[model samples]
Target: MDSEFENQCLEQEENEEYEETESSSVQEKNNDGETTKQLSPREVNTIFNSETEVCEYYRQYGLQNGSGIMIRNTRKIDGVNTYLTVACHRYGEPNQKVVDSLKPKPVVKTNCKARVCAKRMDEDNKWHVTQFDNKHDHDLSPSKAHRFRCNRKLTKHAKRSLNLYDEAGIPMNKSYNALVVEHGGHKNMPFSKKDCENYMREIRKLRLAKGDAVALQNYFNKAQSIDSHFYYSIDLDDENRIKNLFWADARCRATYKEFGDVVAFDTTYLTNKYDMPFAPFVGVNHHGQSILLGCGLVSNEDTITFVWLFRTWLTCMFGNPPNAIITDQDRAMQNAIEQVFPKARHRWCLWHIMKKIPEKLKGYKEYDSIKFQLQNVVYDSIDIDTFEIGWSSMISKFNLENNDWLNGLYEGRHRWIPCFVKDCFWAGMSTTQRSESMNAFFDGYVNAKTSLREFVEKYDNALKDKVEKEVNADTRSLSTTIPCVTPHAMEKQFQENYTNDKFKEFQKEIVNVKYCECMMLQSDEAIFNYQVEEIQYVGDSQTLRTVKYNVVFIKDMELEYEVKCECRLFEFRGIICRHIIKVLLFKQNVFTISSKYILKRWRKNVKRCHSRTKVTYSTWKDTEEKRMYEMVCDAFYRIVDLAAENLERCNHLVGTFKKLELEWDTNDKGCSTSIVTKPEYFVKILMVNVA
Candidate 1:
């Protein structure tokens, strides 16, 4: 009657005469022929209705007495066990053969002579404990009794809770600690943390017995049935094992049509137990938030895998490749991008290249000066000629012509140097920071120990969070506005049109206009050249310096004007710079921004098709009922497609569905009445209508 089994009932007794004799005590003599003591009923003679009950009672008694119990022997008559003996776990000698094995283990058996013998009574068809011994040869550990394997168990409710925690990506240790705290302490808990972990491991093994590939396929199939826009592609090896996987939901595909011009791809994060690389294609949304366009898991980082992933993602997004792509300087990735996205302007991440300077040049005596000059040459160059001149000067000055790392970087300068790649629009990004940020966003949801099956579910949870954040930003943009800091109509125009986050970026340039001074240097019939001197703060010391940029203003036939600046800020970042604003607004008296400059991607009121596609994070168990539900949904989806072709058909289908729902509800409530019908009749009606 321990607390663990308070709700358990004993097996039914066949004879009523022996039921009242469930407990009895006996006296035993000591070795010296003196009466030792009177034993308790459990330690002397106890009657149980079943063999299992007898063994459980003896095990519980051993636990209370600070001893581990194990089944010693059993004698069966034909098929039924007629005699059984339960003994102390340390009641026997270790086998000499096993003790002398090559890989030896410490022996815990001490030949303790404590045991209980049970026999079946033919008259009552019940088991009775005929002999028992409560004495032990070794010291007992009452306080540590719960640590014995025979005493550890997890209840049904605890198992259910642990399964839920496992699905939510909670670590086993944390989940175990939560249970310990809930049960008051570790001693009060029924099982050890290791026991909980073993249970979880067994569950995972059962889930993966069919292989991770099948689990992934079933998950994708169910997801697509729930929402037809969910997309997934799996590449298999010759043995039909999963080699690579790519997935994108409806929201991701819809969002791509708007912000897929520039993408940042990276594969530095690993989230599954298989150690496969997690590659995420990330982009910047209208609110300057990092959005996931699509993602994949690859078994290898070679060119072939990259090609497969890229092509699969391209197909998912309706074959619309990004105009510009940014990634680290991986030669394999570079080759893959060239083969798959030939038209995409591939740029190396400048931050990634710049960060390697210390590691590559730290051995040099003048490493600080070399790094400083290299940064200046990479960042401060105004055009290609200036970059080449500064690069050559730095190499010659540092006597680094023979250095391999520097030479290799110089050969790839056009892919990373700002002055060389400024002509192409990169959405204000010079590195793969967006992809890295997206990876960091999932840190709280997944970890290195996550299984492939668990990772798929956690991925949905993380994406749902991202969607909710975007929706909240949209709501804020619609409900609130940021005030313009300048009197010029251009700042006000941006404030009215752009989202609040983008509007804040525009206001930054307007604020920096005070640091710029523009003066016309030359003039023609329809063209004017101006020199703009801008003050910039440099380094940690905030040293003040002035730099001059050339701005050209050209007037067209219809009085429309075009402005270009040597800085190329607008060309590279899609944002007009402070120097351009000074010349166009302060010098030329221009009032409003041009229509072409207002990117629809950043407009506040532009409706996105992806916003209507809901993202759900609910998980489904792999059961027969779930599979059947998916089949039913798939059939209904086909019917919906046919009905949606015309308004008349759609209305007719909706009316029929309503009538069916009403009849089902009515029938469900009339089950208690005399009038009852099988639900298959409704299915017959539905089948007739479909035919």
Candidate 2:
């Protein structure tokens, strides 16, 4: 019966298409190939195979005649539709009281007596039109007929395409435009951009029908069940609604133990549907890759919220706080960091501070010169004395001693200035760019329309991709080797120890050895001082520039050799500068880089504990196969443990396993090999043998 109904519907659609084509061809021939006449309703004698055909026919008729059709009445007998009455949208009279309340507002009803009535025949099970009226007392608008709700409809295929677009973060207008092009033009499209938006809104409503908070909690619960190491905390308001949320997976927590010395925290991204700020604690791994340590969603950016998020994340990491942290210059964030991480060095992102130069100093008469001098004083100064002198000189020259912004910047200079913060290890980072880059990584998986539930799911997918990338890097580091560019033993030592990324950075400094000239300046008992001049290119012009750096070498019998450069690159970023390399290799004749200089965090062979944890985005079948394989392995482990207790028992067990393997091979050749294709099939065989 269902097949027959579908076949009739298809046939009816084909016939309607043919009639529409014939009518258009007739109009082209009659009116100089322009201006088609509106279609009229079917006569009272017309018959339909089913009641569905009657309603669809009149709906299309109304669309062609620039009228809206609606079902006015329906009669059923024995739980089956027997009679139907369809009418024009303006068939009823407007109520006087309602009309008066909405005075001057145009009413759609005009008491037009246009309708069609159909009755089902008891013998043939067909519908016959008993009454039809084509006359109307209202004006018609054929050009705007498609605007009617009854005339516009989206196919299942189109709805699916729109859903894909929405998931991929494409705008509704762009999705609609793409469909318009696919259909040849806007006029050929059955629905408008507004219709597409309405559909997407309905889709979001359906997705969040169970409430956002409940959906988020359910997702967190599922994640925890899959991985026992998954940690999550939610802060609720008095109404029991989630106000803040934080989560860190097993891998993230494990990674924090290795590279948690310098963390970049930022909250500039707020693209979710709830308007909550997305705060990601980002760190740099051995490969110089940005790794997520933890993430949070907060309803407010106040100190209390930040403190709560920080304490929660810290507890997840077993109360091990980072040695140093980087963030934007937010007063609330500073206060929170002081309270939660009192001993950790807090530095503001230099990029964020320097980015405000144009806004804060643009009003000066010599804005361009002032900006240049300010940047020079902030970046080029090598020590506190030099920075202070340059800052004072610049302020005096610009007559900006009274400037409040400059004074404020100077007061907080230690938080952002490079020279002031160079004593701590930063893992080659000085800004919140790591956190921003992490946010950019999520763009492909989420967007502003993403809900809390969707965000969590997509976040997992993104993190899984990140872990795969890290694994690929680890594989490359283990399998491949980059040849040293120089003949220096230190270069080769670094190449052999560091990952490809860090090796490249070391190579940059080592390769610059030729551009540096070292001269021994002074020497004291077991101490040597040297001045190194380096040739460099500056700005877009690539003009040759010469910069001189001081290097001091101390030879200690107990602690090996120690070399320090005034550039402070090694102290700040853990990368040995060219000056130190020149002073050691060229003058002091130190043949190899000391073990102290080779940071373990950048080593290639260190086995990270996080690599053992499985990511949470595997397919269901893969997960099941893995689980079954582990169970089988565990069973064999027990058998092997008992067998290994005595030599005689081990020998007997080995002999029996060899015999069983031969029997299984013989059975495989006799029966179909497909039977043993799945892990469960092999597990069943093992279970039978054990029983």
Candidate 3:
């Protein structure tokens, strides 16, 4: 009977089943050469006598047997083939051959509950299927049935590299490309870019789950705890969430109080993950470098938020407002400044205002020509009358007289136009360029996707780098002498007095002084003054235009010279214009620049607290915290250096400190009130050093 089944399996492989052997009763033939009506019940029993025979019958009936069936168990009853359990495969194998990674992997799951159990009768010594079920309740899509992940494909090294790249703020696509290159190509790579993308996203999500705002709060709290001068505050919304924040360390506050005469408040930089706008109050140092005074984060640009942010900054600085403040032209910002800094000269950022002109007039017929005319109107105007006349002519020429935007700009020209605010102290900054540079300087440290904790940490790191750069500049300025490129005595004096960067600027104007020649156009005997004039080549008209100015020599205790120029170069910026230099050098026979003309703010020795910023303690507090911190740092390094030079100095210093401790601890109250005590572990360290 087995041989007959084998022959049938080979001959009818395609058809599965064509005939049944004579082990059962032969039934009468029916239509289409089929037989069934004449079969007795005993014939059915004989055909299913063995479980193996039943399996063969199912195979012939074309059942899905590839990994879909399972042999659950088997049992022999009284030394005879008794019973067996069968079930459909729970693990699908759609991509089994491809996912054979030689590492442990999860199998695809399925709800295939098709089961069969066969029993053997003791009398017949044969197995019969007692219970069977082949129908499955769930539908199986061939491709998507197996969707489990294979993490073993990423080796230990790959995972470490992935995390390292993530911490370094490398974007996901770049990290995946790196992995691909390391493995030769994408085809040879064990994992796909999707895996890297998913992994990095999961890590960032976990980091953010720690609460970005909470992280920032904790950092500021810990910092202020260590040093009370590290001022930080957070304004919470009605819902008790962080809405606005302001922070300034001891160094930042000191730098501000010194250079706070002219400041630029930048509120346009928005690159953080939470979309919080950065507001850095920046100032120009003596070296012509941008210095950060303090930073703020706001949830929005509305007047309410800006008001809160500025008030918080004032509170941090002990109510010290800057002399001249500049920012982008925003209505809310303007209102906020009016409310908080009523005494300050609030000016709009020239660059920000100029940047919008192109977009606003983009629909015009001749935009380039109009933009050129606008630049002349905004930048090159000599005085208020000149600026107003030039602006009127440009708008009328361009038929922009009816344009509301142009009219609005003309109305608010005093806030940005240098001619209108020339007498105001700006420290040579016409716009908020210092604040823009400040933003660009911090771009290297923080990114748009950085978390709050990372932002705080990176901000500190960036501040450290900035301070280090300034230190290097200070060292260079002190040790290296500025070389004179011209034979002018005034040039030599400036080189000796000003910083390298400031001297370079002075040289630019000095070299151009040769093209400009001034002559006494008129004389005033009463003031010992002369109306000197110079003719400059006008580029637009291709003509020599004569410009006039007056210079007076007076003795106010000592001999001093004063100048009034329509150029307003010295009035707008602190530096003397080339037109003034022409008269001072050629006609006046003044070799060295007048003492009254050279402002002390641009001196090379700006760090010296003599003529520059005075060392003042915070009026809000009694303690000299910044000075104390500096002294501690200086003393620590000196001690370390001295100890390295002489090992006995360590012991001597420790002994001296211990004696001081005795005096502090032995109070009338008999309590140790000192912040320090005799070291309990220093003896062991001393012994180690001795050995």
Candidate 4:
């Protein structure tokens, strides 16, 4: 038994010695074998898919091969996700080994003529097939020449190569000139008789002066005023006997005799030259349209000058004692208006009043609170007594003053309200905006050099054309389905802007309302005969603290298509007012904004102007496509340079981006080439025996 046990132990010892020897040999073999190369997943994918390494691929490489370079298993080291992968290349045989391990992929060829196709020859050299593109047309046509011979022609790359030259300054190797050149000339069109006279005056100046360049420059400067960009005119006084001569006649009348006596006046500033200003005045008419009474050139916007100009215009045009007047919140202008038309109502413009509330209530912070209340005052939906209470509270909170320029009406409560005027139909027409449109239309005609005579001529022509269109439109409306609101209904809507007592006063005086298209009705003899108060009483009390206006509702004129006013609010918005709404309420089809009121006169003769010109090669032909491609490619390189500069500005941004994979791809054959789409594939042909 003792002998058998000893033999078993010896056998076990022998087996243990053999196993250790085998294990050591295996370890030695592993150490001797090629160092196991580690590669990034991105590098593996690149070699697996294709041979070419793009910007996205190069971005993946680590500095050296067989090193412990960290490979990103996922985009996020923490929380955020990245749309692209980033990796780095490892160098030497280990990287080569990684490349070798990847499955073989066939190299894809770019069939673009813009780039040469080359293949890897061993490691460093590249092999190319010269003139490979010329082997076949690849199309059904015998050649590219036959295919591009239609209306828009093109040359094949082979043909282009034959004509090429090497020039650095000329951009492309082969220069392509435009097929035709446009004329470098201009012509003057027919002008109105007054405009012709102006032109003749300029020509006379040019002919009379034979001087040095400086003198000639001065003469040309004066002569250039003949070019009126916007106005067209014909002279009745001319030898040619042109019937219509246009002149700047900014004059209108406001004959309001009803509801005691009242006249509202306002003025606004306009920019003619980029920085130069012009002031134009407006006189509110009972019709709700502001009458463009006059315009004057002022060096500065101040009260005394405007007041003098306005009083002179009123005396010359309408001649009278306006029992009450309304002006903008300008203290100087208001003071002057009061001095001139002492008998007039002398109220501040409601439009200007509303605009000033925001300035007065500076600490309120909430703009909507002020805007909503003022809108109610203008529209006349909210009760004036209630408005007073609300306004007083806001004024008290803000510590605003009644006499402050921004709160003009707070000192003149009842007089300035729309309901206080007999001409309630014209109540909402406050802003100088409506009259300003005419000036805007004519601003294109005048300039710094414009004389009063030239301005007058341009202004008259525009107004005459406008008035004539309005007159002609009446006939068309009668035939159309558009309706005109009865005058009674118009008065009713105008009443909405006023208080209950004011509406009662308007009803008491206005026996009947008339709806006449185009022509002003002479039937309302009472409107002219209504008593006017010559003596004016200046109220010591302040105006209402807070006034509210609203946009009552909008109505369409089905027949005439001319918007009518009910509250007379249209004049403020430059559309039909609420007075027109009264017209709509009584008769649904009273007025509509049809072709008559909205038709534009200037757009009529466009086709005639177009037909007079002839078509030619200069109008149609352009440069060759290859030249365009070269220009576009150069522009792209410039864009890339700019992008690089922009990136340099934000190094911190670059650091942020470095945390994620942002592989910029710019390896496509068309990266800098203008030929974007691929050409048709040409099947390789091997000569075969014919059947």
Determine the C-alpha RMSD for candidate 1 after optimal superposition of all C-alphas: 12.9
lDDT of 1 by residue, 346-394 (tens): 9988777877887899999999999999888887898899889999999
Candidate lDDT (C-alpha), each: 0.81, 0.82, 0.68, 0.35
| Weakest lDDT window of 10 consecutive positions for candidate 2 | 21-30
Residue 392 error, candidate 2, Å:
1.2
Candidate 3, residues 139-251, lDDT tens digits: the string is 42222212213211566557767866654546678888888899887645666677777766675555445665666676676677666678888888777677877888877
- Looking at model 1, report the run of 10 residues with the lowest lDDT sum: 13-22
TM-scores across all candidates? 0.79, 0.73, 0.63, 0.34
Taking every candidate in turn, the Cα RMSD to the unseen true structure, in Å, is: 12.9, 14.5, 19.5, 26.9
lDDT of 3 at 8: 84
Task: Report the CA-based lDDT of candidate 2 relative to the real structure.
Answer: 0.82
Error of 2 at 253 (Å): 2.6
Backbone clashes in model 1, listed as residue pairs: none
Steric clash pairs (candidate 2): none
Q: Give residue 490's error in model 1 in angstroms.
A: 2.6
Name the runs in model 4 displaced over 4 angstroms.
1-265, 271-291, 299-307, 321-325, 356-364, 377-383, 397-408, 414-454, 477-691
Candidate 3 stretches with Cα past 4 Å from truth are: 1-210, 525-557, 608-691
Question: Which sections of candidate 2 miss by over 4 Å?
Answer: 1-68, 73-84, 88-114, 118-130, 134-165, 170-195, 271-273, 432-439, 442-450, 457-465, 468-472, 475-483, 541-545, 617-691
lDDT of 2 by residue, 242-345 (tens): 79999988899999998999999988766577888888898998998989998999999899999999999999999999999998889999999999999999
For 316-392, candidate 4 gives per-residue lDDT tens digits of 44465554555656677766666776655555565556656567565556656655665544444334565576667
Q: Total backbone clashes of model 2?
A: 0
The order by descending lDDT is: 2, 1, 3, 4
lDDT of 1: 0.81
**Highest-scoring model, TM-score:** 1
